[model samples]
Target: MNMNKREKIYLIAIIVLLGLLLAKSFYLDEYKPVTEDEILFREYVEKVIDDKFHGFFSRSKLIGYRIVSIKKVEDEGVSVIEVKSENEGEYKNAEIDGKYVAKIRKYLFHVLPYGEDKILSRK
Candidate 1:
C-alpha cells in the first residue's frame, strides 16, 4: 500500500468527509417538517369534522381522516392519536374524557399533551 501523494490527499479528504456526513444524516432524517403538534393536530381534526357534521357534507369531509396510529405517553403527559374516518361514520371505540377539545361553532380547538377528548378510540 503505497499511499504517498500526501497519503493520497489525506485519504481522499477522509472519504469525502465520510460521504458528507452520511448525506447530512439522511437529509435531516428524511426531510423532517410538520410539527407544531402536527399542525395543531391537523387543524384540530378539521374542527372535528366541522363540529361533527354541521356543514352537512358538500365537500371537505375531514379529507378522509386516517392516522392509523400515533403514540406518546411521555409519563402520562399524553398523546395517543389513532384516527380513522370512513367518511365520518366513526366506527366506535370512543373515549374523550379530558383535553383534546375541538369545536367549530365558537371556534375552540385544543391540542396539547393529549389524553382523550375524543381522538379516535377503538383499539
Candidate 2:
C-alpha cells in the first residue's frame, strides 16, 4: 500500500498520543486544587491549636492546638496534609483524611503564633 503525506501525519499523531498516555501512568506532572470541603477543612484547621498558639487561639477554641509539623505530599491529585497533633484527635477530619493516611487528623495544626511569628507577622 502507498501512504500519502496526510496519512503519515495521522499516524504520527496517533503514536504521539499513545506515548503521552503511557508516560502519564508512570509520572504526575501537575496538581489540581482541593475541593470546596477541603478548603473548609483547611479553615477549620486554622481554628484548632494549643497554647503555643495562644496569641491567637487564646480567645477562641483554636488555642491549645499544637501542630508540631506539616509535610505536604501528593497522591494522584490531592494533597495529603501530614500533621503531628499535640493532643489526640485535636484536629479531626473524618471525610478527607479518613482513608488515605492514618493518624493524620489527630493533632492541632495551627499552633504557630497568630498574627505573626513574633509581632507584625501575618497569620
In candidate 1, list every pair of residues with a backbone clash. Answer: 96-117, 96-118
Global fold similarity of model 2 (TM-score)? 0.26
What residue pairs are clashing in model 2? 49-64, 49-65, 50-64, 50-65, 51-64, 85-107
Alpha-carbon runs more than 4 Å astray in model 2:
29-123
- How close to the true structure is residue 113 of candidate 2, measured as C-alpha lDDT? 28
TM-scores, in order shown? 0.23, 0.26
Each model's backbone clash number: 2, 6
Candidate 2, 67: how far from true, in Å?
A: 26
Supply the TM-score for candidate 1.
Answer: 0.23
Highest-scoring model, lDDT: 1
lDDT of each: 0.39, 0.38
